[model samples]
Target: MFFTLSYRKTFIGSFDKIGDAIDKLKQHQESYSAISSPRFRKSRSGEIIRIDYGSSDCYYLIEKGERDDRTIN
Candidate 1:
């Protein structure tokens, strides 16, 4: 089996092992957290509507067949 990492529904990269994919996801989360600016949506009244933060929950690990074209090998 091969593991692939996806962020926001976009495939980032394919990995030979699930551990490797997970490590990469952690790296992404750490980097995202380093951003100084906070992400959020504001309302017309100038009130804070939503706040966004870096999280690993958004990253997905998908299992792919070894023969799958997206597999790294």
Candidate 2:
């Protein structure tokens, strides 16, 4: 059996899976040795995941209830 694979460049689709992020994590820095601005999400989902920006290695929010609840989601 033989198989050939080719790749095409395109826009990144929606981030719906953890496995979809296979690209190498790149880091950005400023001349003043300062961290970049942090991103604010509306939900607790992906809250624990630290972004490549700022120096907040251990900063996040903790939701009080389940994420699947009607009011939460």
Candidate 3:
């Protein structure tokens, strides 16, 4: 699965699976300015799972890409 992970609108990486994606996000967990909870979303492109720290500061750790790799879609 081709994923577009980002932090502060900065491109992180393109993982192949949900597990890898989640792992990547966890690596940057402590970097968050605040702490609240996590969230998930399914869009027309792919799944977007993120964590909410506070304010508008959030990391879009998962964004399905259009690459024809090993993806759920």
Candidate 4:
């Protein structure tokens, strides 16, 4: 059986740059493709950016003066 995931958020940046950045990440799925490891839920939600290290994770939070994000229009 094949399970699919729905992406509510859209990746707006350059595909090449995003791929390159994904390569630079240490613990993301892209970096672990070569390793045979159990796949499970990682991120449940993402706003602007997300990062993960060996044992640590981070998510972007909107603080004062910032409105979650900026509008391009």
Candidate 5:
């Protein structure tokens, strides 16, 4: 028999430059998008999780998963 698990992770912190943070993730080829609303919306089955840009240089990142039920969206 085999079993599977859903994985999720979030990164929250402040950065001196947002571009710097973006550049770092880009290097890893991690796909991401900006959160347009206060809440994350669900779309297709394979929706790419989004990140939020807070006041100043603060930000939040949500990792995507194959089938993440942990999030509302």
Candidate 6:
């Protein structure tokens, strides 16, 4: 089986092992989180609220078949 790492629906990289994919995903998330900042929006009552973005859910690990485009026949 092959593993594909994706971020925000875009393909990042393909890996031969699941562990490698997971490690890459973790690294990406950490990097993104470190640079990401919270946004503030005003509600209907004119109260400002902070919206924090979590990088954990933005990354995905997908298992691909042997005949996938990234794999050799």
Best by lDDT: 3
Error of 5 at 58 (Å): 21
Clashes of each: 0, 0, 1, 0, 0, 0
Candidate 6 Cα deviation (angstroms), residue 63: 2.9
Error of 2 at 33 (Å): 12
* lDDT tens per residue, model 6, 1-73: 3333333334546777766755565566566555454232212222211122344343344444443454432
Whole-structure CA lDDT of model 3: 0.51
What C-alpha lDDT values do all the predictions have?
0.43, 0.27, 0.51, 0.30, 0.34, 0.43
lDDT score, candidate 1, position 25: 54
**Candidate 5 lDDT trough over 10 residues, lowest sum:** 1-10
Comparison by lDDT, 1 against 2, better one:
1
Better of 2 and 4 by TM-score: 4
lDDT of 6: 0.43
Model 5: how far residue 54 lies from native, Å: 23
Minimum summed lDDT over a 10-residue window in model 3 is located at 1-10
Where model 1 places Cα greater than 4 Å from the true spot, the runs are: 1-7, 33-59, 66-73
Which pairs clash in model 5?
A: none
TM-score of 4: 0.24
Q: Model 6: runs farther than 4 Å from truth?
A: 1-7, 34-59, 66-73
Candidate 6 differs from the real structure by a C-alpha RMSD in angstroms, to one decimal, of 12.4
Instruction: Show the lowest summed lDDT stretch of 10 residues, model 6.
Output: 42-51
